[model samples]
Target: MHDSKNALSVQKLIADLAGIVRIMDQKDQQLAPAINAPSQSWLETWMTAFWETLCREWASIDQWRMNKVLLLVRFFIREQFGLALEWAVKQDPKLKDQVARQLRVLEAWPLSPRERRVPDGLRLHVLDVWTEELAGQLSAAQKALDEDAENSDPESKKSILLSLAQEFMEPVRKISREAISKGVKIRAKEAVKLAEEQLSG
Candidate 1:
């Protein structure tokens, strides 16, 4: 999407190009097989069409809309893929690990219009790995924390848990600070220092 001066439907044009991008990226595995070897499988074609739509929509949306788009993408992946998700995640633990990395990028929350070039292509790369898969990992982490809590003294637990929470929370605090306009960055200075101290300690 662009300013008023831009001609034609930028949304449609972007979507069209993004459809091609999605197909091209998946050509080797998902798209090529259907084209080269003519599968009568309704399932395969349906899946491809779904992916095409997702990619096209993702490319053409603003940041706020993009959040909704990603949620829909996750929901569709889970719904379209049921028991298969377990097999997929089981087969590729590394892919599950990558989702956290992708989520971190999303959480940083790019400022739309300005940071328009954010590559959600990476998100698509690992989309087959579902939220349950990622959430399960987080649950596992928290479970470990719970187990640790039983063993740790109150002071030790406070230190460890506070340390962990600080680790997770500091990035967002940093971003919220950074999100302030250029003139307001000075205000972020103390928050930035706090994050550094928390991180370093």
Candidate 2:
């Protein structure tokens, strides 16, 4: 019975994650032009709203559940980071050059002594979104495992988590890659048009 319940919980978490990804994708589509606007700071505002929406959705889940879901969230963030960068560059070619320079700075960004820290304030906000709502999930999972050692296998749970993470990543990756590809082509066309205008003028 406990095994079945745990499996259901895992499935629910997967569905929830999928829902979050879908909502984010929709929000991105609705806000893409604004997010990509060269003169606006809409991306930061959108990210904050996204994080807040995620917090509201997962706020009730216990820490252990939140911790498990967070693995998938991290995967989502990594993939979205690439997608967001691609879309940003697509919006403004000048930013492509600026990003190249920033990459050098990122490579040498100083780190504090903390073992697992996201030094950037924005990334710290992302981390806080997860930690604030699910801070007790890890401990709860550990306690549950301790209390039911015979029924719970930590290795098996780890395997399940990994499997779910991959499942969550694949669709998002596919959609983001498609969007980025389309954005790149659009930007290329725009660049050609701008060049032609300058040459004719």
Candidate 3:
């Protein structure tokens, strides 16, 4: 049985690696063959026990095993970064330009600090990639709002804001407090204010 103390750490490591793999598969056309890959139910069942054994004895694990784990983590970090950059390259240039200015701020947003077995450098890299992805999404949204604002008359813009506030209440509220680009945060705050105004008026 895996030691209770280390179980969470092991699970976190697996989750972190799995998340990277998931994103890689999402962004890489080379992995399209996976759609027809054989089912891995048997492998999944076996690996569960294998990981339990590995984590339970990690403290006294041989040097070779430690090196293997370290190398795997490093390899994934490299691949994840390459794939993330490629994905970003295929995105809209206008939105990418907007997100670029705020990418550093987004990457510095605080995440839950936890004690995990994954190397701190790799963990931070993973977080940066995730934050960049979020910035792209937020920038796209802000640009869309800007386009709508330009196209709509004042009264029509109010209607659009009302609809946006109603549809995106939770996300707008969350983004308003996040370390997103000032423009996006301002847009979110405006939506929130509009929502409140309509509620009171």
Tens digits of per-residue lDDT, candidate 2, 122-186, equal 22333333222222333343344456657546555434333332332232233223323444334
lDDT of 1 at 159: 46
Clashes (backbone N, CA, C under 3 Å), per candidate, total 0, 3, 0
Q: Is candidate 1 or candidate 2 better by lDDT?
A: 1
lDDT of 1 by residue, 18-129 (tens): 4543443344245434585533333334455655555456657675455445554554443332222222323344333323333344343321112333344523222233
Q: Which residue pairs clash in candidate 1?
A: none
Model 1 error, position 78 (Å): 1.3
TM-score to native of every candidate shown: 0.28, 0.29, 0.26
Rank list by TM-score: 2, 1, 3
**Error of model 1, residue 171, in angstroms:** 29
Q: State in Å the error of residue 84, model 1.
A: 3.0
Ranking by lDDT: 3, 1, 2
For model 2, the stretches where C-alpha displacement exceeds 4 angstroms are 1-46, 53-60, 88-201
Give the range where candidate 3 is weakest over 10 consecutive residues by summed lDDT. Answer: 104-113
Candidate 1 Cα outliers beyond 4 Å, as residue runs: 1-38, 83-131, 134-201
| lDDT to native, each model | 0.40, 0.39, 0.40
Decide which is better by lDDT, 2 or 3. 3
